[model samples]
Target: MNDKKITKESLVQMPHEDLAALVFNLSTIIQTQNEEIANLKELYKLRTAERYSSSSEQVGYLFQELEILDAVLAGQPEVEETIEVAAHSRKKRKRANACTAPADTPVCDVFHTEGAEDTMTGKDGIVYKRVEDKTINKMAVIPRKMVVECHHYAQYKALDVEAGKDNKKINLPAKTDALGASPSLVASVVVSKFDDHLPLYRQTEIFRREGFFLSRQKLASWVITYYEEL
Candidate 1:
């Protein structure tokens, strides 16, 4: 098998234990390989960004460590949860300041199986709950809603039309007008991209290829705000 390269299709036919062991070993090798690639990529970025720092090496080391762990748990027939490597999880899309119900407002309580920390910490100290209300994340639209009077038919009809909610979202690599929009909001948008697996640097070039001049700094600022808001 040393002379033959493995493909994903072949891996599936192997026994569970064999597959798990092979996957673990392959992931470890990949992690080591990626460390060099990451270092090279970061070096070029630091040189271009002019924000050279000693932490680049540290970041590469951290990635290496992560790769090792990820490799060890790469494949298991009965794996409980899918492991993902990200700066933050995208599911944290709720607002902490949501108007939650009063503490003594409910009566029915249900106990469920325990899981990850994020799922529970958001509501109570439980992963899955019997609650209905969850926080919503919405883009800020200017010019709040207003009532429109419709002078039609026998009965008077009054419609409440929301105005600001129709505001267009500016994607990264897309210029955000220098309107005095909340800086924190901008940052939040940026952070959400990474949390959601949206790599903005690559997005920048892609946008530029399509005639947009988005700066990396602008994207970075948005990411900063996103995490701060969280």
Candidate 2:
């Protein structure tokens, strides 16, 4: 018997008897390995089933079956029992009241005065005078409005150059060095960023919706400037 492993090239060169023996040994080894693998798979399935399977027994007859009831009441006496529950009363729910604005809130009065033609004339030929006014309070909101301020400076030129008066132009100095800086605009940005928790990019979108194209970078610079100044 040959002890060395036989390759395909060696098998082709071997004798007919040796080639037959090699084929038989290879087929037997493959069959044994397949059997071991199948046994391992079955053992693994059995172990998994045992480890995770529930220990409780399956319910045979849910206590509603006549056989279960007879077994349970084999030696017990029959008795009647009654249960009484107390009555409950539910409280009536209160309605929410309308909230009133503060006393200091600015009120805008809309007058609906009677015109001359619509004025009432009594049957006794007497004209009716205004006695009182009826007012209805309704909560109103004024949306934010974008406004552009145009500053025009008047130029003065000296008509008489012969006199000591030379051509000197004077205009009111701006509140700040910034070109379009306003208290209201800055306050709005600061409040929206800090109090309302709105980001500069979102505020830019909001401004775009209002037809004002303000870049997020410009808004960020303004916020930084105001933060430093404060």
Candidate 3:
């Protein structure tokens, strides 16, 4: 039956099974539309709250909303029982000794100690050296300029004792200019782009700031080349 013609008169004239089917279909459509509206409203509210509310307030609002949804789904209206939570205090962490360095990673230790001028006069009128406060801070150094290492192998040419012809010049040690970048450099760039969510254009800008003109296309090719190699 045409939707425009679905009046009470037409519905009443329909057979019992047809009327029931029509009613069921209309109910399902209404239910689906209601659910869609509810979802859209919820999304809008969440977006508004996230944009305008404080972080803590946003978290509380979302949590409370979730609790209400859970209660509604479970068909339970019981007031949630209040439980007194023990106050939580973060424990002070003990200082760790020097950390073991990882593979392919460089680590530096910076030591801070009291200077010779740091001294004290004891009650006995005797001057004594003050106990020194020493701390070893470990840090990874980010290079301001890209580190480009050139390995120069001394090329030794041996002449045949009598009838020398030059042996094909020893192929320089493994190709360093293969990708125009070191394996580590390529790997770092790839990880920074994919794992760290940095874009190639952003990386190119960063490189430019460091006095290098790396193009986005070049960086993209580096990623593609490494992927193909792998």
Candidate 4:
């Protein structure tokens, strides 16, 4: 038998007799391996079935023994059993009061007076004086509002023509590097994106709904510029 591996190229180069012998030997080896694999699979199935059958028989025997024990106990007289437990008391839980808004938070007062009058007058013609006012604090949210701020710089000319001085103008207010975006607006964008987990695209849509057209690219630019400045 040839000990060398028989590839397509080798087979083509080999003589007919050697090739025929190699083919026969390979087929015999494959048949024997397949038979061994089939035998192993059958043996595994037999062992599994035997294990399952023994476990089921043991369980059935246990159940039969329990039934016999139950019948024997039924023939005996019944006896009542009592258990003593110690008395115990549980402490009542105290409820916490609702927390009020922070003192620093801005408050908007809405007064509801009697009879549409600021002061209450009695049935008698006597006048009433204000003593104290009842106030209720509630947290409120104001929706985002977009407004345009126009800056007008006044130019002043020198009254004396002899004075060689340039015209004076008022200083402009401080603003962010991002075009058309204020410091507060940029801060809000940064908080909304990082803290509130809102995406730039969603913020753009929200701004659009609020009648302000802000592109996602523009918002991203503003956020990046603000972060870089910080």
Ranking of models by TM-score: 3, 4, 2, 1
35-152 in candidate 2: lDDT tens per residue? 9999999999999988887663454553467667767667454553444546854444333343678899998987777463535689999987666676888899999778887757
TM-score-best of 3 and 4: 3
Tens-digit lDDT track of model 3 for 153-183: 5565656555367643554544434566677
| 1 or 3, greater by lDDT | 3
In candidate 4, what are the lDDT values of residues 154-200, reduced to their tens digit? 55677777657564444444334325776688889889988998988
Q: Of the pair 2 and 4, which is ahead by TM-score?
A: 4
Q: Candidate 1: lDDT over CA atoms?
A: 0.56
Q: TM-score of each candidate?
A: 0.20, 0.38, 0.41, 0.39
RMSD (Cα, Å) for all candidates, in order, is: 27.0, 22.4, 12.9, 21.9
| Candidate 4 RMSD computed on C-alpha atoms after optimal superposition onto the true structure | 21.9
Mark the 10 consecutive residues where model 3 has the least summed lDDT: 89-98
What TM-score should be assigned to candidate 4?
A: 0.39
How high a TM-score does candidate 1 get?
0.20
Q: Give me the runs in candidate 3 sitting further than 4 Å from their true place.
A: 1-40, 43-115, 121-128, 131-133, 136-145, 149-179
Off by over 4 Å in 4: 1-97, 114-135, 151-178
lDDT of each: 0.56, 0.74, 0.72, 0.74
